[model samples]
Target: MRKLETRTIVVASHNAGKITEIADLIAPFGFAAKSAAELAFDEPDETGTTFEENAAIKALASAKASGLPALSDDSGLMIDALNGAPGVYTANWAERDDGTRDFAMAMEKVQKALQEQGAEKPQERTARFVSVLCLAWPDGHTEFFRGEVEGTIAWPPRGTAGFGYDPIFQPEGHKRTFGEMTAHEKHGWKPGETQALSHRARAFKQFVETCLEG
Candidate 1:
């Protein structure tokens, strides 16, 4: 892996939630993280079909634009019952006609789809959140890390702490949904510590171990 030599990097995303989460994750390593939105960088279209491909696209775009290293993440929810219908299109599923996103609608749609497919039992509602992080340098060199958290879909969408489809996602061994958990609880992974609870946390841990470790 090509180690990230610089301490300052752009987080290639316009989403506020993603920026905050990523910034918090990298802050412990003494990295000066900046979001693409904060830097006035345009969000490149994610034309790739896979998480790795999309992550590379964003990372490379921001790195090239800023002439610095950039980190990008592509994540999604994949349901066993839906046969991963929304894998790469996870965000698209929540996109609104007004150019906004409605995750509550997305959750309801997922629940409805599950019911249509006869996925009633807890076992039948198995799912996972997948994330792939890419680190790219200005010269276009890049590395990728992937993570996933297994879980089951909860009906009636509980909690409101998290954004997106967190209200409907219950990670394995947990009684409460991700939406009910605080940021510290959801992203509780650390280097050489306990296992990660969220997909993004798992992927971020890998990035820290590979690039930020002294």
Candidate 2:
């Protein structure tokens, strides 16, 4: 098989965090990843019902508009205690309130629901972060991959390294929250690079290997 050319691949999102993750993941694969904002592409509505569909929609929109191969991802945190709430709606769930309140709200909702059920919080409040990536070409065809990392939610938040709910999320086998690590520190992958295990990283890694470089 021919190697992927060193062409530009546009990532379909305005979020700096997502763009950074995609750029890092695709950089080693010889693709010069750029964000939609860099290309001046308008944001496409993510009206799809599932993460995969949303990713596809965004990918196609960006690919067609930018006239280049495009990658898009939709990711979220799903707490089993909340019956997988804030799944696809992760961003919007926090839209009406301060970003800092999201985790607290999630925790309160879970606790309240548990109380209503007369069931105590499970010893292990299992939760998982899920990421779905879609790669689209101008021809309208698309490829997809998914990844997940399971963990538990910590109360009152933790360090301030990451954005969003990172302060309250603790991956299994790790004592530090995502918010506690710097961007480089999280991606460093020394003894405690939690970002390497994130859903986005895992999914992008798979996409890079199987779709971009394989």
Candidate 3:
């Protein structure tokens, strides 16, 4: 693993929600982070079929452009009933013709699809959130960490605290959706903890252990 000495790394994403969450994650560790949007980095085409591929595409692009280490996350909600219809295309589902993303519309699409598929029961609505984090350096060195959280799709999406598909995802053992939880509750772990609740957090924990200075 490459030791990341630079603290001010690019987040490699234009998503505001992702940037905020990532910034929060790295804040306690005292590392400075800037998003690709802030740095005016061009968002690259994610032609890869898998999450790792997409994440690496973004991370590497920023690393090369900025000559600094970059971290990128490609995440999505996958419903078993839908055969993971929106896995890598999760964000694509939220894309509007005007180029703005409407996650509310995306959530409705998920619910509609589930209803059409006759996925009424919680078990039938079983799903998982997948997150893949890629850390890339200017020299082309890269590391990948993947994480997942099991959950069921909820109808009439609840809460507004989270972005994307959080309102419709009811994680296992939790009555409320991720949108209902605060950042602390959604992250699911503290600094020294071994486990995390969310897929991004789980993957981030792995990245921190391997790349960041302790």
Candidate 4:
């Protein structure tokens, strides 16, 4: 098993929320995680068609630019009723005329589209959030991990704790939406807690087991 030699790792993303989540996950491993924005690394264009490809692209770009190991993730909500639409274009779906992505608007668009498809019942609105994480070394070696959480879309959106589609996503076996859960509840501060059920959390767990833990 290979272990990281550096005390710092770059999180190749401009999203503050993503960086925070990743940093928290990796904090216990005795590594300092810095965001690309904090390091002044230019954001790379994600031209890949799949989550894994995009994650690798970003991770590699940051690693090459910063001369440090970097981590990146690409995630989206995949609605079964929509035939997995807006998969790679999840953020794009929320782009406004001003070119800013509004997740609330995006969630509304998803609901409207489902209604158009005659998916009136909660059972028909089945969906899952998929996340892919890639860790790229400055030497160009990379490792990938993926995670998913099944859920149903809730109407009128609920909660305000989480970002993006959290308000609308009610994880299986949970009565409350993800947006309702605190950071600790969503990510599981304690062991043996199945309640920590975010897609990003799941992916990070895999990375820890496969790459960080020997």
Candidate 5:
């Protein structure tokens, strides 16, 4: 079926960084994008089992709530050695609250696990960041796209540009890590650049392409 035109877009997330990224992505296309926070939308329970499910749930909820086309993204770090663990629980792998261990704690667990396995060296620890984005429309329509960044884990974390696992993730073919690179440097997408290589960027690019085609 032919997709209808979407004039206004809603991103169902309150994360400033995410909102900024999405806005930057949509700006080039001349689309007006708004965040859930701006609309004062309540955070929906992410009861889905996987990234895709969670993304769809959020997108649908937002679309229904705002009555406008909505988009959502669910992403996490999947470690090969951990059996893809932290895949869906990337946000809450460690602490719960006062003892809450955020991404930093998650990294600590990774390090400890590696030490236990006697493979703490950079060469021994490999990981990838994966992101899945879902788009939902008011008329019960939806679509999905995924992106990933493969890289080795770095100890002690480096830089501070990107958030979450960025400091610890050193992308493939690059000597510096994501957190190490400036935002401008990281967003320098050359022509023919594939968004599938970047976890969030890939998904957003795919969504944009799909929208244009639709």
Candidate 6:
């Protein structure tokens, strides 16, 4: 078992939602998490071809830049109908004309593409959100964890709570979309909650158990 020696760690991401969730998860371990944005850390190019590689790139970049332990994640939706397209390029698919990412537009594009391919049924829309977490130390030691949540894509995107493709993703055994769940509901203490069901949460759980709790 390995343990992190730092009290203050950097979350190597600019996404506020990601930063917030990660901060919450590590709080119990007596870690004071800070976002790379807060530290004005320059965003590094994510040139990796896989989620784990990308996560490691970001984590190492931040760790080296800040001289502190850094945690980073690469997560995205992978649609079977699309042959796992938009996997690493998920965010790229959501880029709008205004240079901002919009999940609504991204979802619309997905539906349009699927429709073009004659995929209309829920079963045909099978997909999953995959997350890979990487923890890196300034000295170059690194760890990785991966997790995924299977679901089907729902048309007419539902919910308003979660960010990204949450509105259109319906987890298996659940009628409601992730976007419909409140923060507390999404990350609640109970089993089957988002904290338990979410890919990021699952990956972070492994991180906690293997690194923080050791």
Best by lDDT: 3
Model 2, residue 188: what's the lDDT? 40
TM-scores of the models, in the order given = 0.97, 0.82, 0.97, 0.94, 0.88, 0.93
Pairs clashing within candidate 2: 161-179, 162-179
**Local accuracy of candidate 2 as per-residue lDDT tens digits, 1-214:** 1223447888899877678767766665467677889888888888988899899989999999978888899988887766787789777755544443354565455546545655444344668889998888887888888988777776657886666667767777777877786665444432223345777777766665666553
Task: List all candidate RMSDs to the true structure.
Answer: 1.1, 4.0, 1.1, 1.7, 2.4, 2.2
Instruction: Tell how far residue 27 is off in model 5, in angstroms.
Output: 1.5
lDDT of 4: 0.87
lDDT of each: 0.91, 0.73, 0.92, 0.87, 0.77, 0.86
Better of 5 and 6 by TM-score: 6
Give one digit per residue, the lDDT tens place, for model 6 in 1-214: 4477678989999988888777776776677778899999999999999999999999999999999999999999999999997899999999988888887889999999899878999999999999999999998999999988899999899988878888998888789888988755555433323357778877877777688663
Regions of candidate 4 where Cα sits further than 4 Å from its true position: 189-196
Candidate 4 shows a clash count of 0
In model 5, how large is the Cα lDDT of residue 212?
A: 65
Task: Give lDDT for model 6.
Answer: 0.86
Order by TM-score, highest first: 3, 1, 4, 6, 5, 2
lDDT by residue for model 1 (1-214), tens: 8888889999999988888888878877788888899999988899999999999999999999999999999999999999987899999999999989989889889999999999999999999999999999999899999999999999988999878899999999999999999988999776567678899999998888888776
Candidate 4 lDDT over 1-214, as tens digits, reads 3566777889999987788888877777788777899988887888999999999999999999889999899999999999997788898898899977799999999999999999989899999999999999988899998989999999989999878888999998889898899887777543344444788888887877777666
| CA lDDT for candidate 2 | 0.73
lDDT of 5 by residue, 81-180 (tens): 7778778888777555785457778778877876777777666778888888888987768888888878888888899787777788888888888889
How far in Å is the alpha carbon of 191 misplaced in model 4? Answer: 6.2
